[model samples]
Target: MTLGTHGEAGLERGRVDLQRYGHALMGTYGEPMRVLARGEGSWVWDADGNRYLDLLGGIAVNALGHAHPAWVAAIAHQAATLAQASNFFATEPQIRLAERLLELAHAPHGSRVFLCNSGTEANEAAFKMARKTGKRTVIALEGGFHGRSMGALSMTHKDAIRAPFAPLLDTVVFVPRDDEAALRAAATEHAADLAAIIVEPIQGESGVRPLAQGFLAAARELTRRYDALLIMDEVQTGVARTGAWFAHQLYGIQPDVMTLAKGLGGGFPVGAVLAFGERVGSLLAKGDHGTTFGGNALAAAAANATLDVIEAEHLLDHAKAVGEHLRAGLEALDGVVEVRGAGLMLGVGLAAPVSAQVAQAAVAAGFIVNPPSPDTIRLVPALTLTTAEADLFIAWMAEHGTRITTEGTTA
Candidate 1:
């Protein structure tokens, strides 16, 4: 519904729903934000009938954007045909999606893929696989966010959360993000006991900072030196978010193991871990690990359909072109410290700690944006976003950026 017919009533109803949501739901995320009702393309309509240009793209999950025909059709068709089955049974879409990912990743012929429900679960599976290697220690970068589950949380290097879950397995080492010296020292210090070294091609949560090519190469070298697995956590940067099927494509360096999610199933919940080459691929035998609803038919079909749309529509090239436009425009703005990232995944750095205010003002002005930190605004808009739409947000930033930043805001 647009704003014309149901403006005030819809908003009131939405507020009521939010109140109900507060009492009925757990308070993990605190109060409700927006009672988003529906979406299409790069726009979403709230229950209040207000419209928003969705620049956040549901935190990089909606690769194809809202209500894409192909995405809807795939899920509907799969649900009508065969929605799910036991792990004991295999489905066509599940197998096809797995094969397609391996092919896109350019993994070896016999490489393996493990499917799960979300990025965290994918990381959990990767963590279990790392443990199976018999090495007691694993190294991960600081500011890296894997997931919230116990094991994934251990790998996640957040002091605020990690402190609460202290004295974890103590098997994971945290290296400063993008610190070449720290990485080398950690790798050297724990080289013998290292099971795997997990790094994000682009740090998503802490900030949208892409790891340097040389740093990625160094991590690969360190892993190889200790005979440890190099695992790339491309959960946020994979599935064409970074102008490539995988962000690792930009580096031209391959990891022995890779975790992917976010856009894997477009809007559906699906995650995967692909183990490259023969030896690592064969690590998880029959009963060694399992998933009940990881690669169910519906989610797999959605993923397969998302892949087809990405290729057929040539969104990758579109992302590159439009991303340049967005970045250049944002960088030209006052107070914009820098803009970093490839394709639709971009982080806008500000001179002061005003990202939260910027994001709030953007949303209030009818745009959806995110503050990853006090100083960085993240934009992971839908790949389907048009250059015109990007220009619209750019104009908004140019006009309101300074004023919006000075005001402490929330959306």
Candidate 2:
């Protein structure tokens, strides 16, 4: 955690950037934390040249870690060859990436892909697709996070985010997460007119709670019975974040529609909707939905490179093993309450509501973490994280566990 003095000059420069950033940028993200200078693998350096282990992975966006060679090469090559093309004419990377994504999703040949720039846009497209089914009702899990766009925001469960925008889209019902009974009851009540049921295979924002396998299966059954589409919002749990290509695969359930973003492009902004059905492609006709930069060459190339490196390096197996190590080590910490979630997307519970303090303490101790709520600390570190790094974080927790729970809040 010791910051060397040699980079003091660079740190001052970072301060200048922070000052300019504050004045020029919008306050939607609140105050700046540290001006990050550079990163590689699982580590990042700040403006003051302080080093820290990035445990959050840019909120689960940096799948291959920063400055990965394959990602860098792919971006550079695509930028040089073809940055973007008119949507009227498809680029090779775009076509290739779409085909690759379908294969990864285990989707059949007739399945299709709708690319976009972010998770919110992907959900918006999905929402429109659902409406095209001629059904008026939709179901979403409470506390589930779809996106910030109007339609996606309407399906989200948090009141704090929804209060400012009271009039969200209507007829979107809510069911308790992981509760099969409530989900079934809602389906029974609205099955006749339901368009779709949007569910996160594992609810990431709600403290890493995964829906039960039975619940996911039941959703499929109900949707099939009522002729409704099943939408798996895998924006956070996709791209091997859960040790599988997608979390729904673990449950062995096939959704009609799947939305992806966070890790899809290896830190680049990209989102996609994977629709798989005999007639899926025909639902959204031309001009029914589109984005100017959705399937650009550069982003698709980044995504292709990310997928390429993941398979080449066997990061999926690595994520599984390291996640098990982290789970067991975190549970061994004295004041730790529980460890939830799959693979690298973990949530560490504390004996007290001091997750904020523990996160701050972690920052001072040279680690980056997220305190999404009061009692739970979310860890979505890069899949590239190694067991040694996991062990280092475990040692850090073991050394500072009790203090983190007790003294963390005060600071």
Candidate 3:
């Protein structure tokens, strides 16, 4: 596993050369660990001949896990059948996915979907649909990460992330997440000038923070009273990740528009904006907005397969059981202050800012956890993660907690 050498047969020789070639080729991501050679189920192998159980699950993208037979077959079949068709022509997968989305939405009637390429694109499309209401203002929750695109960035809460992209789309106000008063005042005051109120049922990138039950309902009611659209960005919490078709369903709230991505296509790129009823659905007309790669045959086929697997496998119930076990174990950690979120989208809050060190230890221990903040460690594992895998992560957390505490004390 030397940094500059190649490996033997079937061993991912690219691991060593990847760092060198990657430095000269790609941007921003830097050198990835072990040059991930292959993956199956909930495990991945790096170039150095190391295998690890994937607790992070590609940031919650690989719902059915790596190299699921169904997904592989679907993609290969679709590739052989039809990979891409210009938006001018209709495709079966696209139509099927659209129908499935509406059924998942369970909207009254006449709900429509606008397909796209990523979570950012989904949010951008939602922003476009919100704008079409002839209003320009939006109220977003603090500590929420929507996407990096202009419109999505505008709704993002972190100052550091937003300051770099200064002079972003204006009229987007951010209020503390789970703070009902601030949301109520802002939405009511600027009701007429507001286009929509965007909120994530469980804030993903800022750490897995779920909005308070009453708080989300208030947003819905406020949007209704102010005649503003309510947008639920489920990019990180949809598609059985939270043991539901969508996270908002847990709170019994219905959003006017719902944006989805992340796990939607398992691993393939796919995004969508679901608008309920005529008032919101008709906002975008022909030629109003579109993406060249949006709803392409390949992405649609992948998404359809992903949905079918979720349904046939009953992964939602599995997620609920495993998530509960994971959360209980995490909450039992000594220095752990609290455990938040539901289903597989769980976050652990530490007594101090040791999450980075804890995450490093977890990496060494073969688990991948995201430290979204100094004190918040988020875990969004694949939906198909087995009970054994869940228990292993719990054990890892207990050991890592002790390691982190000892290191902190010694420091």
Candidate 4:
């Protein structure tokens, strides 16, 4: 199949690909909505050559958007030069990536970075770090999602996903989101055994819900008082996605440990754990943890390239301005109740529980969005997305919002 092929031949190819996908892949994600063939910037083309604006940005992973020139060139260069090296050896890209992350994070002296392959792995490492404190209990907020791996899953709050995998790490406790009193009470009750408190500054899975400043302040104070680590899971909100380098920076709170992925590698798979100071940095000593493909040359090159592009292009300010434009546009629509979140990460709150239907209609209208909850439509578009591109979606919503919300379909 050629890159720009279309028409009847393309449609037939798409049908065959979907059939193959059904037969060859697991049912974990049910079925993909479309057989995507290629992407550039904020747009993706299906196998049938139909294009759609990718508002979800691979669920907040593609910070530079798809097939970015610099990102692609960097990966190609690294792959040709030196792709992999075992943990026994260290490569330049790997070391440089770690240094860059620490520098970008403004880590104090003795801070450290541990690079891994996915958000789950980063959180799993974090779970071990908490356990290293010789404590057994950890606190996570209700409606918060860490990752799908066993250890990360243990920290997640949803019952449906967790119930299937019984006998998880029983040491973790859940608290209501943004409820300072509950968090304080939980910390006090478990102070003796509290290893850490893991939180998402803005909970992405439940909806783009930001934790209140006061709530975050309380968590910081309580953790300090209890001598427990404050772990920030910035897997979705990190890497300039929220206009800030990290979401916690927005509130002027620094966590002892921070987990990052998604946009870190732009589209390549990479995750990292940033230890803030000497105390937390030394938790995972030599041989305490390890990974095969964690910070290999190729992955590090990709991540470094992603960070480079974000800085050179001034994407941080771009995200902030475009995000505000989107928020204002959505809020002006008839069916929208409000807009939540910061930067390019936003949730359009609807006046009715019709987000699923609206999202479906959006795809039909050549846009891609996600309904994380029935009342919220998530927009985590590429940081490079322009205001003009955003207006296209805003226009669509303005034209179809009334019918989709009330009638459950655009047609």
Candidate 5:
């Protein structure tokens, strides 16, 4: 069960028993990676005894990487002291975490924080708030992924993901991404009835694609002009993943509502929606939204510690430096077509659809990367990633690039 004890050993054992004993488990994620036993810093040891530099960082959630001293200590201290009390009582960590989030968000006057357990729940809460204003229509972008919940899925882009659950909530319109003209048309066309315009500053689940900075600015402008709220989904791009507190900051835009998760808790489960301006915050009254484990003491403590370390260690600047190194190295490779993203959230475009093969080669070479799409490899390493580790990964890619291209299919 420990690292180095088995190479491809427990993998077989786990696979067999998982098939037998875990039959009740759904096949949603297609039987996750053999099994990850332990992680330290940016490395994870798999059940097969393979140690890999985790470039994905739990899909941008592990901003501090795995088992960070501060995060671990904070969670342990909070758990031993006061884990959870019912919502009837307030906690210091929760209040502090809320204040910290407001500071990062630069929330407008009358802003309020609504905490939750996951990105889906955050979006679900956002939807209810929008609904309370008696508005039924929402404007979403193509390739945007809100969540899997009924309300959130209605705003997601892909049809294959939504078709099975036919007749999803009505009045959700999907527009092409980064098209200012199209956005203008949609907003003008729906102005009379639209409630909110929801978008991700950088689309992570859709393969690390970034929206044009001006496009985001335009969304803010249009939403304001139309008397609709601008909802920025920062679940994967917030918490310094994009070299900023939130990706929208790069464009100098302030959204009315911002949803955050992933890195907010380092690795702990926490999600929240920061509603700005007096009007939007008050829309969700006492009975409008609630969650059981949203603001528990332990989760808040972890989040507080994560934010403290991010600022104390200046991880935002570190993410920018290391991410630039990684991106530049990938772009220099002979077969790479393009590199896209900001900070640690990166996507590599290959001339061919060999990204999956390249990912396997990377693992063999003692690195872990994610092939979000056949031709795109996404690297969302910890914000605290060091230059040496980044260079090591770059060197591995330089050596294997040609092999991956020659042995695999072209896009």
Candidate 6:
């Protein structure tokens, strides 16, 4: 169907679409802010025909931005050739994608990849791998977000979300992020039963807070000492989102296991669990785990194309440069206190608890961003976001920053 047509017709279409959406869908997400119709590089148009700079990049899923030509072509070609073949048989794209991931990750010999369809599924697989260790305890960080599924939610630290799902796995322990002492203490206490210590290199949901280098080193050391796995949840920070191919690479630490999604598929739905070394690779035996559509030809082709485009377009360097540009701009804004994170994954800290207001104002002014916390605005825009696009948001913030924050306070 034609979407984003201009004028009152578009407005009417949007309204009708929203009404239908409300009636047909679950309210788990409350309400979608807009009926986005179509998208291109760094921008999207709603059903109402309003254009917006998509700085959120579908929450960092669109690594190549919306509708990248190469990514689209790969998917199209693969779909025509072969899309799905159950786990009973594997395809060339699937095998090649796994090899590519191992090479990009610099995984050691005997390393393996388990492909899946989303971040939660990848985390779930990791959880099972941890369980396969014959140990019961896992140490996770406070304010960390793994995913919404039962297995992932158990390891997640959010109380509100977990409260409803009472009786989550009790063996998991929570430690404060970057608190090396607490982490060491927990590791020592749970040494015998410790299966793994899962962490996000940068806590995306908790305001893009990166784990201290020393703390990550400590986790690595402790996990080794206790013979437990170190799982880095790079779902939000992998695939060149953080300038580096993976955030852990920046710290010079390698995880025994790494979970990836988001940008891996570059807008297509795909996830992966990389098990380092032969020992970790054999954690899940045949019949231990399976998926119907994971790493299907189409998904693998999309991901391969994404990695290809990222390299060909030199997006790693571009992300770093544009990210620095955006960070400086955000930090220079009137109400912005600081900017945290690397590459396109940024959190704009505000002087007041008005990030929600700022995000609202941003969208109204034709930019799209999100407030992960009351005082932090998250910007996980596409790797393709240009300095020109970033400057537009920056300029708008410069003009309206103080007013939006003030209005939020008065309201």
Specify the highest-lDDT model's number: 4
Candidate 6 residue-wise lDDT at 355: 85
- Candidate 4, residues 1-411, lDDT tens digits: the string is 112333455478778898999999999998888899899999999988888899999999999999999999999999999999888899999999999989989999999999999999999999999999999899999999999999999999999999999889999999999999999999999999999999999999998999999999999998899999999999999999999999999999999999999999999999999999998999999999999999999999999999999999999999999999999999988888899999999999998899988887787778899999999999999999999999989988988855687666666
Off by over 4 Å in 1: 1-10, 406-411
Task: List candidate 5 segments past 4 Å from native.
Answer: 1-24, 406-411
lDDT of 2 by residue, 7-79 (tens): 3454677778889999999998987778888999999988777788999999999999989998999999999
Q: Model 2 residue 309 lDDT?
A: 95
Looking at model 1, residue 171 earns an lDDT score of 89
In the range 127-166, model 1's lDDT, one tens digit per residue, is: 8888888887889988899988889999998888878877
* Candidates 1 and 3 compared by lDDT, better number: 1
Better of 2 and 5 by lDDT: 2
lDDT against the true structure, each candidate: 0.88, 0.88, 0.86, 0.93, 0.86, 0.91
Q: In model 2, how large is the Cα lDDT of residue 159? A: 88
Instruction: Kindly indicate the candidate among 3 and 4 with the higher TM-score.
Output: 4
User: What is the model-wide C-alpha lDDT for candidate 5?
Assistant: 0.86
lDDT of 3: 0.86
Candidate 6 lDDT over residue span 159-245, tens digit each: 999999889999999999999999999999999999999999999998989889999999999999999999999999999999999
Worst 10 residues of 4 by lDDT: 1-10
- The segments of candidate 6 whose C-alpha lies over 4 angstroms from its true place after superposition are 1-10, 406-411
- Deviation from native of the Cα of residue 257 in model 3, angstroms: 0.3
Segments in model 3 whose C-alpha atoms lie over 4 Å from true places: 1-15, 406-411
* Ranking 1 against 6 by TM-score, winner: 6
Off by over 4 Å in 2: 1-14, 406-411
Residue 56, model 3: Cα distance from true site in angstroms: 1.0
Ranking by TM-score: 4, 6, 1, 2, 5, 3
- TM-score for every candidate vs. truth? 0.96, 0.96, 0.94, 0.97, 0.95, 0.97
Over 4 Å off, model 4 = 1-10
Q: Cα deviation in Å at residue 82, candidate 3?
A: 0.5
